[model samples]
Target: MDRITPRQALRMVVIAATALCFLMPLYWLTISALRPEADIFRFLNPFGPWTLIPNQLTADNIVGLWSGSFSRAIVNSIVVALVTVIAGLMVCASAAFALAVIEFPGRGVVFTTMIVSFLIPFDAIAVPLYSIMRGFNLQNSYAGLVLPGIGNGLAVFLLRQFFQGIPKELREAAMVDGMGWFRIFWSIYLPLSRPALVSAALIMFIFQWQAYLWPLLIAPSNDMKVAAVALAQFSSAYNVSFGLIFAGAAFLSLIPMLIFVFFQQYFTSSVAATGSKE
Candidate 1:
């Protein structure tokens, strides 16, 4: 039997503490959402077990969310995120294929520009983008919500790296067999690059799912409001409902968390492959 050394025991303690620090917020949010509204902040000043574990749990907060515009917002967000993921994957994957497989002029420069574009905070360009959407008469529409997320730079970069990692010999052989670029990309590269595609899809889904400012700008009407934007409205209402806010946020977080958990293996592999290839 193996015995733990002092150093190994200390390392385990440190790891447990770090993980607790990361999970504490989520734990608090879950408890807050379950607790009675008045009790939500009762343990804040002198934190205790009650700070995380509520004395009484209620479904009212969660149930109340469905009674308001929040339910609509959730639906709108799901529709937008799904559309963004599907469209973004297609656009990003095609761009990646071009950058990775095709011989083209200024490809490096284009890729560099794409990388730099994502580095520039999206907020910086939000106003101009809002104006552009308005000009296209897409304001207060799903198209407005879905269009920006479809051109995700990071998704493109991730796919491009993964595409580059695929062996060139496969592409050459396919060409020798008289397969066209589109056919090769659709049939060969797409099938082999599932991990990268899942990673990129997660990226686009998260971008649209968590979107606030852009949705606020482009689709402010109650009918078109997204979950994040709706959550913000909760705090600003005449009587702020912290419990509802927490519940909505908890619900909002569950989808992405579940998605990453399910696809985490693929996401990790794709990222590691990109790092090695790069």
Candidate 2:
């Protein structure tokens, strides 16, 4: 093995420091969630012993959150996120497949238009969107929550590029096998495109999971609140309990963390592959 060079040592130190900076917030959150409210507020040094080592550990706050509004909000979030994932995958993947593999007139223009649509931020269109949903009487409904945000241009772009990278020989071979377009897409490309699909699905899951503004605006009813909105409610409540709020937040974070951990291989590989050029 080669001896460690000073340059490599410096690079390693910089990378370690950067990673710690990113992780510090999560560490602090976890620490606060576990510790008692008195210790958290009393010991103010965020990076000090209080955060690094909690003197008083408590699960009551976490339990309270579960017993209170957190459960309902979590369920709502799950329903919305799952629907977004399923619908987003279907719409984005199908559009991506056609744009990537199937040739047609004005295809370039259509692709460019789709890509450009991402520049139109949702905040810019929120008023019009609300009016349309209101017109359809979709407010406070899951349909209102899931429908407007499901048109994911980024997913389509990513999956389309990945699909385009696939070898033409496969399509030619499928045609020789007497497979029609739909049969070829279903039997061959879809199966082979699992990585990109999973990446897109995971992306949408996380997006919808953390979705706050749209859900809050479109589905603000108590019964329809999601985890993100509920978090705000925790803060806005008359008796603000930081311990319980942190506990709830830490618990809420687990779903996405667990998702990324479980499917990390798929997520990373697919993202890298999608970005890779032919």
Candidate 3:
């Protein structure tokens, strides 16, 4: 029943303008994917003169991409992302539990060291990392791709902060009833920390899925390339099919969009839980 003030009206206009700025590129990409090659070149035409005939719409690019190595790249990306999430979550959870709940002589020192490691840029260490991979003959291997991302310090630190907020009384009660560390972790801490875990998993999955440079560096072969890497190849100078490139890019974008749409409630809850802890 309340009327809007001039300041509130101005704020609404600003928000709407910002949303349009962000969404315009995505709209353009979707339209480019749907349109034939001719329409794409006439993209500069205004809405009044640019007539988009329905008959021109074709799914040929999508079909062609599906039939090519893009399909296999999709499967590979899913496998790699899932593997990275599961492995990263398990390692981070265990490390976080130890850092948060368990006390040792040098526990604080160890935790500080882990936190500091987060500042060391991964790009700076790529040469040494590649040599280590070569020494193990892991180049162009799936294990090689998944292994390096499993122990991220950021994940460990985020989860550890959440773990530390859990009441000690509950953990002590579980211990008194003869529940060991693993049992307590699985039955109590993990179940209670679902929000944080989901948020962490989603973040890790997106990072791993969109990863271009590392995957390209480690796995150059078509058999091992991921969706992002495949997109780069699709856009290369020798093979420039704009429609196909747009289709592939749109398809790659859809996976993360679908993920966020489906799991956004959990993601929001996880972020809220983290804030609540603070």
Candidate 4:
């Protein structure tokens, strides 16, 4: 490899600084979770020498967090996020394929409606959705947790944009071969749209993972609570223990981190291909 030029060295420095900026908070959280409570609040600012290395490391916090109701909540979160990603992928990808490939008079109207729905936050429809779910007797159930999140408008929009980038000839040739729309979508488009599918799944996964309000609204019972809601349950009028809270949060952060690491390649591909329509 050639020696690094002055300009390249400067760019490398800037990139390192940016990475450090993001990594510092995670480092702090990890160390704080590892340290005992007395060591954590020894300084006014959390970035003191005490917390820097955590000389008095302890696993009590992690043990306590993982051994309690939070453990069940974590499993609940996994179930909800996985289900959301799977259902969201199916619904969004199918809708996007239709909007991108199929010709219909009201297609534009439907797409525009979906785009508009993106502007409407879930809070706007929470009460009505709760009423509907209650009518169906699905509250505090996995179906209730998963249904509200499927076919997210933004997921459909991104997948549709990606789908539109595919060559028209592919679908036309499949049509000429007498393959139905579903077959063409399955064999021709889905196989080629891996990046977009992974991208949408990651988006919905994060969305469902971080969800608090919807789950709290419809599934407030301890048996049905998600990890995010369970995090809030740690706080009370009499107690505000940062040690346990931080440990629980740090543990919760691991799932998404592992997920992103696994999907890192597809995510990069999806991002690079975002605007490159054929």
Candidate 5:
């Protein structure tokens, strides 16, 4: 192998430094989770050896987190995420298809309005959303969790872009053959748009899984709480348990990491395709 030049070496150093900056908090969390509770404050003795003593390793924190309502929260998060993905895909895909394929009046206006809606922050809608849910008696229910995720403006925009990229000839030929619009969509458009679908699903799943504020505000009970909200119940200002808190956090991190790993190829390909079109 050729030796790296000065420029290459400098680039490598910059990349390494950037990676370390991102990974430092994660490393600290893992180390803190494994350290004995007493040694967590050892940073106060700046000159002391930084070694993690072997006796500090314990599964008590992990076990405790799992035994409490944490496990239930994990299940709740998984269910809500899956439901959200299914609901979002069904609604967004159909809406995208209509906007892309049909020549309806006000189509451009409607599409533009949907895109503009994405700019509105969730905080702006929280109060009105809560009142609407309260009126429907959906608070603290799975329906409450899944309903909000189904109407994402970004999902509709992304799928519409992908749908518009489909060749017009294919749809025209399908129509000439007397095929219904729905059949053409199912047979041609959807199969070719798998990459976009997977990409959108992965993004939506992460957003739903890690949602904190809405779930926290609407679903405060143990039975309805998601993992992000449940994790907060473990810590308080005065009575903090560093090991257990970190353990719970580490466990929570793994869920999204696994989802991303599973769909990483589709995500990369879809993003590359989207970028190339622009």
Candidate 6:
């Protein structure tokens, strides 16, 4: 076995400690959810082992969530995220393909404008967007929830960067063999762009998944509320249920973590490829 130097051992200790610092809140949230409603705050003031570990566990919080609009909100969030991922990928990927592979007037200008769009704050345009959705009679509809997410600028930029990394020879060869642009994109570019596609899917999925303000503005009704918005409704001026809040937070936080863990390799690949190319 290789012996560790004192400096290397110290580095490992520091890294472990840093990781624990970040994980502590998540650990507390999970345990708080499992704890009895009263016990959820009992351990916080004079913090001790009990603060980190639940002595009496209960499933009431978790069970109660499914009995209300929270369940519907989770389903709504899933539907919205999936739709955004599928539709966003198609729209962004096609735009990326055009920007990267096709020759057109003002392509550079168009791509630059897109790159600038993501930098703008969504909050700045939320009210105007809400008005537009209402005007189109899309308020309280999934279409309203999904339309804004489909034109993800960062996803387009990421896909376009990855697409640019592919050799032009492949596209040229396909064209020489009478392959149409759509066929060439479908048969060649897509098969080779799995990592980029996964990355873009994650972006669009996260955009819709974490949506709060937009969903609140566009779909205020209980039937159309998403998980984030539903989480907020758990609180009230009269009484606040910290147990339910913690439970909902734990459930909401677990999803993105699972997704990122599952698709982490593809995400890393796409990020590295994008950075290296452009």
In angstroms, give how far residue 22 of model 5 lies from its true place. Answer: 0.6
Error in Å for residue 182 of model 1: 1.7
lDDT of 2 by residue, 182-241 (tens): 898888888988878887887778678767788878988988888899898889999998
Better model by lDDT: candidate 2 vs candidate 6: 6
Compared with the true structure, model 2 gives a TM-score of 0.88
Q: After superposition, how far is residue 74 of candidate 6 from its true place, in Å?
A: 0.8
Local distance difference test scores for all models: 0.90, 0.84, 0.83, 0.87, 0.82, 0.89
Tens digits of per-residue lDDT for model 3, 9-71:
999999999998997777677767787865676745666444433336788878887998889
Clashing pairs in 5: none
Query: What residue runs in model 1 are displaced by over 4 Å at the alpha carbon?
Result: 1-6, 105-113, 267-278
Instruction: lDDT for model 6, please.
Output: 0.89
Q: Per-residue lDDT for 1-278 in model 1, tens only?
A: 29999999999999999999998898889888888888998877697877777899999999998997799999999999998888889999999999999999999998998899899899789999999889999999999999888888899899999999999999999999999999999999999988778878878887887788899999999999999999998999999999899999999988888887888787677679799998
Best by lDDT: 1
lDDT score, candidate 1, position 101:
93
lDDT of 2 at 136: 95
Per-residue lDDT value at 40 in model 3: 72
Model 2 stretches astray by more than 4 angstroms: 1-9, 45-48, 267-278
Best by TM-score: 6
Which residue pairs in model 6 clash with each other? none
Sliding window of 10 residues with minimal summed lDDT for model 2: 44-53
Q: What is the C-alpha lDDT profile of model 4 across 77-132, one tens digit per residue?
A: 99999888988899999999999989999998999999998888887798898999
lDDT of 5: 0.82
